[model samples]
Target: MPAVKVRKEEAERAKRLLKRLGLYDGRRRPKREGEWVLLPAVGGDAIGTLGYEVLPLELPLRPERQLYKNLESILAERLSEDELKHLRRYDVIGDVAVIQIPPELEHRVDDIVWGLRRVHPFLRVIARKGFHEGKFRIRDYSIIWGEERLNTVHRENGVEIAVDLSKAFFNPRMKGERYRLAQLVKDGERVLIPFAGVLPYALVIARYRRVKITAVELNRDAYELGLENVRRNERKLRGEIEFIHGDAFKVLPELPGHDRVISPTPRGVDALALTLPKAERWLHYYDFVHEDEIAAFRRRITEECRRLGRECEVRVKKVSDFKPHVFKVCADVKLG
Candidate 1:
């Protein structure tokens, strides 16, 4: 394997360029040696022309789950093209694999289970996922195979989080988004996070940045799990966390302003008017919006900022797809 050696500051830019030219190796994890980062790349004629030193070194492969299409590859021979199109992506939390079996593929549940088990040989449970229910947003899950429990210790972004699908909410797909936010956060900044389920965002940020984070959650189970998670990663974290079990609507009003306010707002709940006022510098507000309404969403946030008498700049980024033509977006609001 050929790897390029570039300064840490230029690593991201080089990786992007390599990816654009189809030379970056997505399967291998980059290794950092002090000021330089070793980026894995495919052997090519262009490798020597990239200016950076290219060395033949074996880099460690990323986790199998991050590859994302292994299960689909295993099932390609077992299922037809029409059935394959209905195959949705699944999440592997710790040792449990949770997937939604659509009506079209419900008859092939056994094959799906076999594929998942083959892909993740250490998997202890394979669950059929259901819609999120109640105010806590905990999903309804049925253990179709292996262990009869929904509890597992999920590891992501350098932290361990204990989650119980029957009790609380956790999304493993947000790992990259969480890391992006963590990198944006500065050391010593006072941060506030509302609807902090199991403290995923807080833990990841604190693991890298030395800051004081105050996270609030309304659900008792989530709050308890979040406290446990803090203890689980206390030694690894560089910052401090103060977890409060309370409703953000009532609690944030009594609290003082922070350098940054992150509202992982629940679906259908409008916390813009509630959270934007508490941010002294930056506000990362998450919401679901139709593609057509993204401009309207930006206007709404701008209007709220104006109403609050704060001069603001709002940049909306599509985080993920929620449904057809609908996306989960984050409005990064910077205030003066």
Candidate 2:
């Protein structure tokens, strides 16, 4: 076995070198033949996805132009461990760490999966999560993420939820609403939740008080997943929970009036301009769209209210800004 000797200076240089190459705290470093150390891949940031992201395999030598080419060969050669069709990489948290590969790379995810598990077989393979910004890392205490740990949780409010870190799926940042609903909901509020993904919000509300929840979801897969989650944790629920596989726009009119409704959606919210013109009920929107777009969206709601002759009370809350970019911002939105 050959020992890849590193002088004190060289090791320090390697740390900086790899850091620039998108390798961080948890990257495997070969000290000698067949011996590697998986360091702590961790960091912290107030705004961003899960704080820390894993550092996967790296090249033997720096081949910046040939990175993809090297990774391609590594995949075709079956260099990875367990097959994972869902794993992906990103430079979301760190600009240099971010790299975009085509969806076809899904076939190659196996290489990465196999590669990581061989070195750290016990770690859970959380797939398809995005990357960290410069200040953020998966190891960061505040971020609270890792494949080994489940992102979602059963809130004290009794809602069993799968945390959608991407915000494309769910935003855990909507912590304030938990308090708002607790105060507003009465003994038996008939509540409607459109586009319910896992019904995390509804579950929390149900835990706080007795309520009849009619949740509408559009995607078949998501709706089914939500049902399973609801069933698994039914004991935690205090009220009747119903799941409907229907489009909100198509079904909103058919359903009877309710005391309250929740519309928590859009990871990088654009605006509700499309729905504003026909807005009927008071709405709460919590998603990241453009700041400028909210006004136009409100106007649309005003027009819709006028036509229907309904009192449309609306509220928009900026849940959190997930990331900052040169021309755009990803944020959480709530419309009421």
Candidate 3:
């Protein structure tokens, strides 16, 4: 096995950097020798790219630890060590625990749910069947324990959002990104969030800034929930947020222009030209790209702006990784 050796003091920072670069291998524990920490790498090529010393060593395979406490304790007797490694990670939305059960462990779902409930008594467990599909970007989930409902109120950065997991798409991992975006909003500016699922972006921004926000959603259920969320946090908000229930492309052209536009949908950047109120507007566009394709992705955006006859100054930021070698990225475009 190949590993990167770093000073013990720099180990934690190096770990985060490697993970962000999609080069960290979590299956093996790091070895410590004197002042150096040996971190496992996914491949040999990462050493040159990361500027680290690569050390080849013989190490034994260890059982990957489970995030949920009782899952390992309960399944230890019933399943082999290899079977336990399949349980990677799960997401928690309010009182609900959303997990993806591997196809090989389909028959043991009942036991898995039981163990999860034992760890978090108040949590309602749901199993995600597959990747988010269709135009709506919603995933299929089956209730495995506790409540049968999918509706829950999630609190993020002093904002409360009512979301139906089956009807709308909301990623709790984006809490930091939402807060950062809200902080960038100037007072008394107009903002727009297209594909505003359950109004998470709108609510968070409105709670912090005095800007007026227009949120557009196509799904009827998500639109209704967005309305409820607006009322739920009306007293705490410092700004006005209007919930519009219609296709973003159809509704954007009809609404007034905004100083800043947030196209939160990864696939919605092309529609931004239609929503621009005038030249010199700030555009925050989200998209997914391969680790090695960021430069090409920005080039595409630059070409799109040229095709639309809008001059753009663009900057790219990596928000998070969706899977191995694939990242969720944001392009901050200043169009004039």
C-alpha TM-scores of all predictions: 0.82, 0.48, 0.77
Candidate 2 Cα misplacement greater than 4 A, ranges: 1-123, 126-128, 131-158, 162-168, 175-179, 266-281, 322-336
Each prediction's total of clashing residue pairs, residues at least 3 apart in sequence or on different chains, is 0, 40, 0
TM-score of 3: 0.77
| Clash count, candidate 1 | 0
Whose lDDT is higher: candidate 1's or candidate 2's?
1
**What does candidate 3's lDDT look like per residue over 1-336, in tens digits?**
678899999998998898888787866678889999988877766567777887776443333233453577677767778888786566778778788889777788877777777766777646554667666788788877777888888888998888888888888878989999999899999898888888899999999999888888998888898899999999999999988888887888787768999887744245545544432488888888797999997887788788878788888988977889888988888887
Candidate 2 structure quality by residue, lDDT tens digits, 1-336: 111233444555545444544434322334332333323223433112323222333424322223433444455457334332333332122111223334655555445555444433344433444443221112221221244433444343446564333331443434456657656667677777776765667777776778888888776656766777678677876877888987777776677767666665444433344333222333455554466676665565566566655655545444444445121221222223
Q: List the global CA lDDT of all models.
A: 0.93, 0.48, 0.79
Residue 149 of model 1 has an lDDT of 93
Residues 148-238, model 1: lDDT tens digits: 8998999999999999889999999899899999999999999999999989999999999999999999999999999999999989999
Clashing pairs in 3: none
Better of 1 and 3 by lDDT: 1
Query: Deviation in angstroms for 50 in model 2?
Result: 36
The parts of candidate 1 lying over 4 Å away from their true place are 1-67
Model 3: runs farther than 4 Å from truth? 1-78, 266-272, 275-279, 308-310
For candidate 3, what's the RMSD? 5.9
